[model samples]
Target: MLKQIANLDQNSGNTFKLLTDETGCCGDSITPCKYVAAVPVANSVSAVVVKDRDGNNQTVTFAAAATTVKAIRDALVTAVNSVGYEDDGNVLPGISVETVSTNKVVTIVGELIVVSLTTSGGSVAATATCTEVGICEFYVEWGGGASKVLTVNGVNATLGDLTFATASAANVKSALEGAANWPSGAVATVVKNTDDSIFEITVTNAQSTVAFILDGLRLTRSNCIVDYV
Candidate 1:
């Protein structure tokens, strides 16, 4: 858990450092906080590796979608923010991203930040362009070693018990959204993957405009996949 909130371990001392120019070394009073810059090429992608307080590492990525400078920069902002976005069940460490983007140049700052960019960190493609595949849409895998239970509205139930691999799509939807937990509704897409397998039980969906927090529903394993339910 390499989080930037510093001080969880009182013995660690004030281990916070501000960002400085690439030339200057750490522990210096600098103009900008510690950050990485990049200029991505067309159809390029980027990722940030962050550690939590307990030495847990999580990689956040901005798929190779952004083709414009501003779009890539903005996407970087979102990608960095997605650090500990999900997985609230485990309550992992946290960090923040803030900077000034001018002329489509973006800067990410934190005490200890490791950033990887495609094309050029400061020299990227004509911005970035591409359609995002995942954001609000989630798929429910019928099988594949996923043992998920749902707490709908308020009642807890075994998802696998109600639905099986041969179940119809309508029944799958009923089992997911119209569960006993109407107070906080759930959503899903019951389509078969390339292998016609159901590895993921359910996901936060984008099928409808009406979105809710999914009151009692939570995945202890893959909850970190999305922030909003």
Candidate 2:
């Protein structure tokens, strides 16, 4: 002779306190109880860090999903410009940066002498007698594919030819200094080595000339092409 009864309770919060029991209240009676459990929901956020070229440390931080590649590239460019060239303000003039689409190039325009003479001076005589003379005129011709001519002096003289009166050292020297039509494209200098004495003429363009044609008392051509490609 047993009897059973059940009861339930509700709470105000999202969570519920549970209570359970299984027993006979009277001789054979039982009461049952039950409750609900609660769970929590969480939200996650993402972020990123930006670093310098040296990789030493990050200079800035950004929201991960909010940042774009274009924005990051612009930031890098700004940082580079602010840092300046080589970390020094003494960058040379006439140098500029050019951008071609996705390609970046740097161009530098300058003038430099490419062709040079190693040996030029030789002994000349007048009337079979050695006299003090200098070089009067020196002409150089293009030996490479390009056709070009260069005159080192203006005065009328002879070179590389002994058939005429041998020019003295003084005559040769005077000719080099007194040429009226000398081309200003290059510079002519005298260099004395330990073993030999010679004159050097440096040409502005090496590939433009093939050989030098000396026209004076005698006409002679010497192969002066040092490099060709």
Candidate 3:
């Protein structure tokens, strides 16, 4: 869901960030006090070779001199958007190029891979906590906005579900953690902020016998920018 944290105008004296949901959980809620778009941290990449769903290859090359994070991000976006990146008569579905916090972030919904990497490469890999081989798609929401759908793989056994009232993230976590015969063979854990506004699902024991795939990390919203908050 689309979420926004605001600052009160001292003159206007309007309600501001440190948000609270209808459940009456305020700044103490599980939501982050501040949510800023993620930027590339220090790390270098000589080149990033990406393969599309159609097996078409696109190479994002970083100039040896372009060592800064911004430079690498710019080069990657430019190369991916270059003509002929997509296969003839085909479109890259649900893939978006965006600038967040001055960093380039790609929201990919299908299979993608880095065929090659150099020592300059940073540890860029999937974040889904899946350890099995099937795919599961679900709708997740933060605060009181529309739900965003994400397709996750078996590796990502952990997922978050939110409720406004008597239901708390703890309750959800307890149920999931207590589930029987988890397919991923991993026990799950749920965590929420003290205020219970935000929550996360994770695996107690992480195994990688099978690869995990995630449709995308951020949700699609206005202006083609993936909303992280």
lDDT of 1 at 132: 20
Candidate with best TM-score: 3
Model 2 / residue 150 / CA error / Å:
9.9
Give one digit per residue, the lDDT tens place, for model 2 in 145-181. 1112223333333333212134333434344444454
**Between candidates 1 and 3, the lDDT winner:** 1
Give the clash count for model 1: 36
Ranking, lDDT, top scorer first: 1, 3, 2
TM-score, prediction 1: 0.27
Worst 10 residues of 1 by lDDT: 85-94
TM-score of candidate 2 to 2 decimals: 0.20
At residue 156, what lDDT does model 2 achieve?
33
Please give the distance, in angstroms, between residue 124's alpha carbon in candidate 2 and its true position after superposition.
Answer: 52
lDDT of 1 at 194: 36
Kindly indicate the candidate among 2 and 3 with the higher lDDT. 3
> What TM-score do all the candidates reach, one by one?
0.27, 0.20, 0.30
What's the lDDT of the predicted structure labeled candidate 1?
A: 0.40
